[model samples]
Target: TGVASGIAQWENNAFPGDRLDQLDVTNGQVFVQKVDGPVQFFAQLGAYSLPDLGSPYIRSGKATGNFYGAFPQWFVKYAPNDSMSVLAGNLPTLIGAEYTFSFENVNVERGLLWNQENAVNRGVQVNYTTGPLALSFSWNDGFFSNRYSWLWGSATYTINPSNIVAFIGGGSVNTETVSSAVTPLYQNNEQIYNVIYTHTSGPWTLVPYIQYTSVPSDPQLGTAQRASTFGAALLATYALDGGYSVAGRVEYISSTGDANAGAPSLIYGPGSNAWSLTITPTYQKGVFFARGELSYVKATSTTPGFAFGPTGTNTSQTRLLVETGILF
Candidate 1:
């Protein structure tokens, strides 16, 4: 069990105050497992509060959170052995996923490309092992609901073990908006691909990876629609001399154009490109540990434009995020 919190102040971003500042409470969780078995059980719950939590209106809507659920996940796993398994409920998203709760991640925040493209979903997933390869797929409720139908699946393969380790595969995300909450309905989907290379020794490891999102525009928006968007990033981590470790990631994000930019009420951004940086520092000791992270999400402007303002639409908002937590 564990609990922790932090106070983050910012300039020119989202939050409730005379200025951009927020006092937020990060979430917490708990777990219990047997001494030995192919199975274990866990559950998590958290309370997140910040000024100006986005609302169901405005670009991603505008408001404040007495509590913002941080993708809190609960699931059950059955491992017949080490080669195959199945899971249910809110599950672990793969690849870039969300900006938090990544067990092996050292970055305080995730890439904007990841936030705009990859995400954790809830539903059912299967795990399988074949020699040196691992495979997975997911079907869950997506980031949008009611007006849209959602399904997602991803896979990973590990090969070339030695000084150079590698993982390769891809995922496909699908959604359809048939109901009109704001305007003419449409469909959206993407094919995502990523790969990573790593070398490790003792308590240290270094990894670098590349990712891409191929978005196909909606026919409803006509041919002026933007083509697929691709992004690249580099991330590295090192264990230090002070019983601590640090990580940093830089990514350049680009979006062609919204096929659904013409939606009923929601609005997307103006520019086709944006940049994000994530930094994380962590400390650990025996049965207890703590982590701190700072992330900067920026685009070309902050005019408070109301694109993709919910109504069940997808929109990316620029933000400054800081989080600290402890576990025992």
Candidate 2:
């Protein structure tokens, strides 16, 4: 799949702000998969220059020069029996509601909570499935870092084909030299709970989801801190005549945590809340599709940099974005 996009944005007030307008190729990739007997191989390589539209609400890493980027997925899977399988390589993390692929999501930009979660895992995994219940376990390099190790487990229950619930938990620990004479091992733990329901009737389809994440303090730090975030999202799409459709999404996320005194953690800072609404109208014909989206985000926080401006200032911020994309 390949995608090209143009974006325009505006913010009420911000510090170290991002570019307000840009055009780039968001995704250009080819996926190849081969299946033979019980063995399967898959790989996705791509070049992207999409705008950073999620974290901090505005700025992100952008591809430089020509079209060049990193491969997001590559893995191999082997099924030993009807109910068991093994996989190894750089694979997508099993913890999030949104996928790494842009086309697989309902909106052009991912939600606030999704941006903070892990994106990929490099290691091995095992899965077992029976009836409507599936269980999986994995050990991998933490997030995008190979210096740390993480272990994850997930259980999914299917209540019929349209309703499902899943629970995923993972954690990692790393030892770092704090100073010239002392080294402390830091522990990071995370857990996610999710529920999803999909219902389709006539030309209308609706999906409602809820997710929660918890993070405890690192014992190695000078100040112990704990953080948690709870979020919910709803997506709805209505199909129209002549291969046209309208889709919309609404999401809310709230986070709470204490500021760390030493090493940085992945948890959100103290007392922050955000909500967004997006509407996309699209046209699809065969392998070609075009979509236009309008989105708005409003956030509030007591922590300075946590919301808009530098620390100890700026209490709230709002952002609006317009994006258009075409994919083949």
State each model's CA lDDT, in order: 0.48, 0.62
Worst 10 residues of 2 by lDDT: 179-188
Candidate with top TM-score is 2
Candidate 1 stretches with Cα past 4 Å from truth are: 13-19, 32-40, 48-71, 97-99, 102-104, 144-155, 159-175, 178-188, 201-204, 219-226, 258-271, 286-323
lDDT per residue (tens digit) for residues 169-269 in model 1 = 34334445433222122223445666666656666666656666554555643434544555667776678876688877777665555424531211134
Q: lDDT of model 2 at residue 194?
A: 65
TM-scores vs. true structure, each candidate: 0.69, 0.79
Please give the distance, in angstroms, between residue 255's alpha carbon in candidate 1 and its true position after superposition: 1.9
Looking at model 1, residue 86 earns an lDDT score of 74
- Total backbone collisions for each predicted model: 15, 0
